[model samples]
Target: GGWPDAVTGSKKNALRRAIQYVETIIQTDISSVDNIRKDPVKVRDLMLSLARNTATVATVKTIRDDMVRGDADNALSAPTIYGYLNALERMFVVEDLPAWSPSLRSKTTIRTSPKRHFVDPSIATAVMRLTPGRLLKDFLFFGFLFESLCIRDLRIYADGNDGQVFHYRDANGLEADAVVVLNDGRWGAVEVKLGTKEIEEAAIHLRKLKERINTEKMMEPSFLLILTAGTYAYRREDGVLVVPLACLKD
Candidate 1:
C-alpha cells in the first residue's frame, strides 16, 4: 500500500483516493503560493515525469511540449515550469539533489544538473498507482524509487551530521549517486544499489570518483559506501560499506 492508503482506509480504493489527495495538495499549495493559477495538472504531470525520468533541462522541455500537445494555451514556458518547481520546493513536495564538484587532476568538466525527487518517495508510488507487486515486477523503476528512498534517508542523516547530500557527474561520464559532505571539510561518496549483485559495480564507481579528485586541493574521501537491499550491514574487503536499508535507523 502507498501513502494514499492512509486516507482511503483500504487498498481497494487507495490508488484513486491517493491520486485525488495528491491533486488536492498540489492545487492547495499552488493557490497558497501566489499567482501560479491552479496548475495541479501541470504539477501532477511534473510529478509523473519526476518519477519516470531524470529531472534535467531536457525533461523540462519535454514537459513544455507535453503541455502544448494537449492545447497550445496550456503551454508553460521554462520560467513558469521552474517557478512552479520553486514553489514545490517551498512546499516540501519536491527537492533536488545538487551536483558536487571537487578539484580534479584532469580537466573533465562537471555536470551541474540537479536530480529532482519527491520528499517522500511514497508520493511517487502513489502518483504512479504502483503497489508492491507492481514495483517488484518492474525492477528498473524499482531501482530509481529505491535510490530516491536512499537519498531521502541520507538527507535526514546528513542534516543531523551538519552535512549535505549531493550527486556527482563529470563530462568523462563518471558519476556517484550520492556525495555526503560535511561543513568541516570531511566528505564521503555513496552509491545506491537495490541489489547486492550491483554492489561491486557501485563500489568501482565510488572509487573511481575518489581517484579523480585532486587530493592536494581537496581532501581524500572519508569513506565509500553503497546502500543496498541486503540483510546484514558489513564492510567489504575492498573498503566500501554495504548497508541494508533496514539498518539505516537511529
Candidate 2:
C-alpha cells in the first residue's frame, strides 16, 4: 500500500480539520453579538458622543447625567466608556471614518481627529436617551445624527460597488464632508447639512473641489449632492443638488 508523495496519508486530513476550526472562530467570534452586549448602554453612549466630535471626551459625571439621569456617581468613567466603544468597534458595531488627504501635493494633511458612526443610528439615539419628541425639537443634534446615517448608508452603497468614501479639505479651509470616488477615478462631492433653509456653502465647496482638480479625462459626478433635512430633492442653478437624507438609502 505504498502511496505517492502527493497523496500523503493522514497529514491532509489533520490540516483540513485545523483550517475548518480556525475559519469558524474567525467568522463567528470577531463580530459576535454576545461580546457587544456586555455593556450596551455604555457602548452606545461612547459611539454617539464620538459621532459628534471624536477628540471630545465626556466625563463620568456627564455620561451619568446623559445616560442614567441621576447622580454623577452612576455615570460610567471615561476610560470605561472608551473601552466599551473600542470593544464594540472590534465587534463591527461601530465604524470610525478617518480624515482623508486627496494627494501629496494638495497640501492638505489628514487630521488626527476621526468621526465616529454606529452601524445603526437608532443605537446612537438610544444611548443618548433621546426620544422622538426630543429629536423633533433638537434640530442641530438631529441634523448630526442624520448626517451620520447618510454617511453610513453611502458607505454601504459605495462598498457594494467599486468606489471609495472620503472627506475632502484643503489648506485654504475648503471642505466637503463626503467624497464618492468611482472605479474609474471619477468623483462625486457631497456635503451634509441639516436644514431646508437656503445656504450656498455646499455649492461653494463643490465648486472649489472642481476648480482645484479640473480634469476632462475623468467624468465627474453628474451632480453634487447636498444631503439635508429637506422634504424633497431638487437641483439648484449652481449645479449642486439638494437631496433629502432619505434619498441616500432609497
Candidate 3:
C-alpha cells in the first residue's frame, strides 16, 4: 500500500501502541510528578479534536468548541485548553505553525492563529479511528491529514538546516501551507496538494505570495515549491518545483 492506502486499521493499531506509551508516560511522569491539575478526560478530548483537524489553522476557541461538541462535559475554558496544548508541546506530542508576519506589497493583515499538527500523521489516524478506505472516500479531509504528514517531515529537515517551519495566511485569504526560514534569513515557500490536478493553481498561489512579500525587508525566497501526491516530479515553466511527497527526502 502507498501513502493514502497505507492508512489501514492495522497501521493505525501499530501507531496506537506508541500513543499508549506516550499517554502512560504523561499520566505517570509529567502530569503526576509535576502535579498538573488539568482533567485527563479534557486532555484526551483536546488531543482527539486536534487530531481531527490535523493541518488546518485552529484557535483555542475553535478547539474548545470541538471538545464541548463531542462531549458537553468538556466545556473547558480557553486558558485551560491553552494549558493542555502547552503541555502537549512540552511533551513533543504536538506543535503549532506560527503565522509568518512578513512585510508585504499590500495591506493584507496576517491571521495569527497557528495551524495545529501532531508530530506524526499516524497519531491523528489512530485518534480519529480513520482507515484507508474511509480516507480514500474522503479526499477533502484526507488532504488535510496528508498536509500534516508533509509538515512533519518538513519540520524534521528544517531543524537539520537550523531552519524553522511557519505557515502564511493573510486577511485577504491567500495562504501558503508551509514556509521554511533558515537562521541566516533565507527562506522558501511551499504549498501541499494531495492531487495533481491542483498543481497549477497551487503554483499560481505561490507566485502571488512571492509577489506580495516586500523584498526590501526580506531576502527573495530561495525557491518556491509545490509538494504533491502525484507520481511525477518536475519543475514548471514558472520555476516552481513540483515534488511528489513520496520523493521528499527531508
Top candidate on lDDT is 3
Worst 10 residues of 2 by lDDT: 51-60
Clashes of 1: 0
Error of 1 at 30 (Å): 1.8
Winner of 1 and 3 under lDDT: 3
What lDDT is obtained when candidate 3 is compared to the true structure?
Answer: 0.82
Q: Between the candidate structures 1 and 3, which one is better when assessed by TM-score?
A: 3
Q: What's the best-to-worst order under lDDT?
A: 3, 1, 2
| lDDT against the true structure, each candidate | 0.80, 0.62, 0.82
In the range 58-168, model 3's lDDT, one tens digit per residue, is 778888888898666649888877777777788777877898888887787899888998887766766666667877898898899889888988987899989999999
lDDT, residue 135, model 3: 76
The CA lDDT at 129 in model 3 is 60
Backbone clash numbers for all candidates listed: 0, 0, 0
lDDT per residue, candidate 1, 97-206, as tens digits?
Answer: 89998889998999998887888777788777787788899988888888888888899899999999999988888888889999998999998888778888888998
Runs off by more than 4 Å, candidate 2:
1-48, 51-83, 104-112, 214-222
